[model samples]
Target: MNALLSKIFCAQRVLKNTPPQGEIPDDETLLRRTFRVAWPSTLESFLVALVGMVDTIMVSRLGAYAIAAVGLTTQPKFICLAVFMSLNIAVSALVARRKGEGDREGANRVLAQSMVLTVMFAIVITAIAILFAEPILRLTGSNAETHESAAAYFRIISAGMIFNVMSMVINAAQRGAGNTKIAMRTNLVSNGVNIVFNYLLIEGHFGFPRLGVAGAAVATVIGTMVALAMSVLSVAHPEGFLYLQFQKKRFRLERSTLATIANIGSSSLAEQLFLRFGFLTYAMIVARLGTTAFAAHQVGMNVITISFAFGDGLSVASVALVGQSLGEKRGDLARIYLSFCQRVGLFCSLTLAVVYSVVSRDVFRLFSSEEEILVYGEMIMRMVALIVIMQVAQVISSGCLRGAGDTKYVAIVSLVSVACIRPLAGYVFTYPLGMGLFGAWIGLVLDQFMRLILTSIRVRSGKWLNIRI
Candidate 1:
């Protein structure tokens, strides 16, 4: 038990307290302090990834074709999420700043506007995704057999965009205000619900009719709906940090607040779109490679996504802390927060990479048993582990940039890294050199290295603070 606890907290940041009234801690303290805040977040990511893995497994059983289909579908979903999720981060940054400066009303105003924006964008994105699901699936290199399966699955899951957006927005808001436990609990219960529903609905266990791929869709939707309810209850509860008593007057968003969100968040939305776009391209390339490679990439990607949750949670916390410090006009505090997060991220990526390297086969087995797909998944997983150090640097530095209202620069960097660098590298590696799946993995690894070096330099140079967003 003690060993497990140590593994969890090893080299993690400990920004569990509200930032001090006046002074930022010293560099040594910043370097050495256990990242306590990151611990819950890392565990929270584990639970979320577990659900994702289960979702992949439930779909994988139908066959690699289904796995490929869903995997292809998820590429766009990440971008879709990036769009709406940026607004959530915008809200979090704004609210954290206000809260840091001791202005509750300011924070509440940001939350109120965030809710309105989240719903409006959700409706717009959902319509486009649902209406164009078939074409998008076609573009993903599907045959007739795969397209029909993917379309049904995507359309069903896409139906719940509003719910997913709401949960994400509110959760970001809560986390920014230093209330992460609630979001953690919300995900835990929500993932459990998703797992149970997937088991019963997919296999037709206990009187449920077999729904196959569509059943996985249904389970995800139900999970989102339940999570949405919990988030609403949290917002309604007076004690919650982000609970908003939405007044008709407050609904008229002040231009200043609206501008703050848009100025920063537009970059985030764009960054997400491009990032996902690049991922979609990667998916397309994998599809072009062949169905087996595509399926392995899908399952392997899911496992990687689970590992990614750790970096993401830490990044989110970094954003809150860094943004709050900047809001308080304490650049020193921001620096401390940024440094601590980078160190913790490095530690996490290294540890998780080691684990991925050791238990990769078992991890791959959770998704598929087909010799071809399993081999592909294991190779990608190991490759990802090798690149873990670079991944850590990129995630932390990106988060630091985002927290400083430097969303535009971050967006630009993402485009260069994922869109230009990764896909281009993948093409070069695969087509010219004939590296295949290993080549694709190499592309990703190199892209990550470029981002880590560039973003770290950007953070250390302090140019991000000059951005007006």
Candidate 2:
């Protein structure tokens, strides 16, 4: 076992054009550096995903329509967040670079500008989402049974967008500055709040009104509000690496900073658009499979999301470590760190794959008791075990590229694989081949592998090291 694990984690052995074994940091040193940042972020994301799965379990008791209704709001919520998501990517990358360059004020400037943009965008998007909630849910393939509930959930969630986006931008900056523990703490508290409220309001426990689907949305919003407060406080300390200056002079945005944000964020926005479009279309295709199937699909997705949490946490570490290394003009170290990240990501993915395969049936049973839903969920989750291996690797690769300011390449990859190939393949398999939910998942699997292949090629070429922010 020790020998096998050694082979799995020997990063330099697998990477192309790597430095000599003695040139890079020893394995113990790399592991400590990586996990120092990774463990908190990993725990944060895992807890949040765990809470989300628990939230679904609670809602599942309300039946398949309820689960489907909640699921219907998923893509639209992310779509609403796309702008800030893109901006935050820029914030994290830029901040990490500035930190490595030892320009404290520049990092803070990036934070201020991103916060300003997040606020302006959030307000407009929130209003649009609220006004057009019905049409949007309908477009997501919401039927009469789930439409009204989904719309209510969507509207409530949309109204709270300001809090969520604000917290997100702040957390992004924190992560880039290598202050990952702050964001982790904030999210952990936030998820805790969400679960408590969900218990109180979901089924009317402790004299609370039973709000059902609407309650879940309310719980989520309330949690984000808490997170926003904690995030703001995190940077309020004067001695912190990232201090939030509220004064007029310090808070005003500069044209050069905005231009930099635009340079990186524009491509990131394109990537987000492609991802959302492809995911939305794929989801709509599956929704057409009827409520039970979609519910099972949602459950399967929730389980897969648990695996995604680990990948996302590691990806955050990669972005910060890679960006900082490049800023310090040590491209060799950047490559080394990236390779180590990939190795760690592989270990995590393989571990999750095994666990998912072993307990696929029991995991589905946690969400529902229906024989048909269980059967569908088990098959889809078995696929998830394979998909996660590819998904984690690609996600980390993309993060490494983005950290190097190679957003355009990642964006192009998303365009070709996510926007074009995924949905097209899904449609053919679902309708033409009559493969149903499982077919849609095959498209997802294909998408992950395509991304892994393309991004791996880009990483091997080593051109991203020369790209400048």
Candidate 3:
């Protein structure tokens, strides 16, 4: 196992070198650097996803109603987080560019400005989520029984949005400064804390009160607070790569910096909102298929999300490397990093696909005992295996584009492929044709293929090279 792992890590050493711009590293050196930034990020993402799986498994014991309720909240929660998450993309890109230019003060200023915006947005989202949680759940097609627990979970989690968004943006800024390990460590510790609290609170172990679904929300909020503290400390450390001395004087907004981040982030915000809207529509279609099918769909999605962690990890590396390379005015180097990231992402996806295909049944058995759910989930897992192959390419390529400040085109593609095509196809397949849950997945797979083709075209065209942050 160790030998196989070593070989995988060393695989990039063999890629033919791109023609050098002055002082560009050789292939081996560059690959090693990329690995250093990527592996920790990847492992961190995997661990976080794994914790989510554990959370689902723990809650599954409460009944399918609990699972479905939680599942229903996923897209709505993402919609709330979308704006801050989008801004993090801009924070990362600007930080990477400034770091590459060797302007430490500029990078620090960007981080400071982002922190200000992060707090403001989090407050607004928290208020809306708390005040309208029930309505929001109902809008997503949650039935009465599910709506009650979903509302509880949403309100508590929403109350902690400030901490969660702060932690996320700070970590993103760290990644932009080529310090992925700090973010990785912070996330790992936070997840560890979450799991422990989940065990105690959810089941009332160790004499803790059994708050059930609300317990999960409380645990998550506490975990996020811990992470936020860690993130702030990392950034405040004197020797840290992106240290900022937080002071009243430094907290004032600079209009130009705000404009720059907004310019880059607006498209990302639109993309996320559109994608979330499409997901809600897709979920509603599945929900209409009845509770059993929707529960199975949710279980299958939890399993599939693990594979996404692999692509997400590589995407993080792609964003950092491509942004820094562009900052250095080395478009050729950015291309090389993107190619390397895509290859690594492909390998990870294919390996995950094989594992998922072989163990589909056993995996579903962990989530539910119902024969119908297990059977439907197994079939969905097979589709997920195929989707991962195409999805990885699209994800990594989009990250590369974001790093280049070319978010508008990525947003347009998502609006067309995911927002328009996916749910529309899912509705047609699920109802008019009566294909059921399997039919819905087929629509999702088609969406991935469309995105893959479009993103691949954009990356190859080199139009992103002209984008200015």
- Point to the candidate with the largest TM-score: 2
TM-score of each: 0.91, 0.97, 0.96
Number of backbone-clashing residue pairs for each candidate, in the order shown: 7, 0, 0
Local accuracy by lDDT, each model: 0.78, 0.91, 0.87
What tens-digit string does per-residue lDDT give for candidate 2 at 300-351?
Answer: 8898889988888888999999999889887877887888788888989999
User: Which residue runs of candidate 3 sit more than 4 Å off their true CA positions?
Assistant: 1-19
Question: RMSD to native for every prediction?
Answer: 4.1, 1.8, 2.4
lDDT of 1 by residue, 300-417 (tens): 7777777677777788778777777777777666766776676677777889888988987787788777887777767887887877767766887887788778888788888999
lDDT of model 1, residue 353: 85
- Of models 1 and 3, which has the larger lDDT? 3
Considering summed lDDT, which 10 consecutive residues are worst modelled in model 2? 14-23
- Compare the candidates by lDDT and give the number of the best one: 2
lDDT of model 1, residue 92: 73
lDDT of 3 at 14: 30
lDDT of 1: 0.78
- The regions of model 1 sitting more than 4 angstroms off are 1-36, 466-469
Q: Pairing residues by index, what is the TM-score of model 1?
A: 0.91
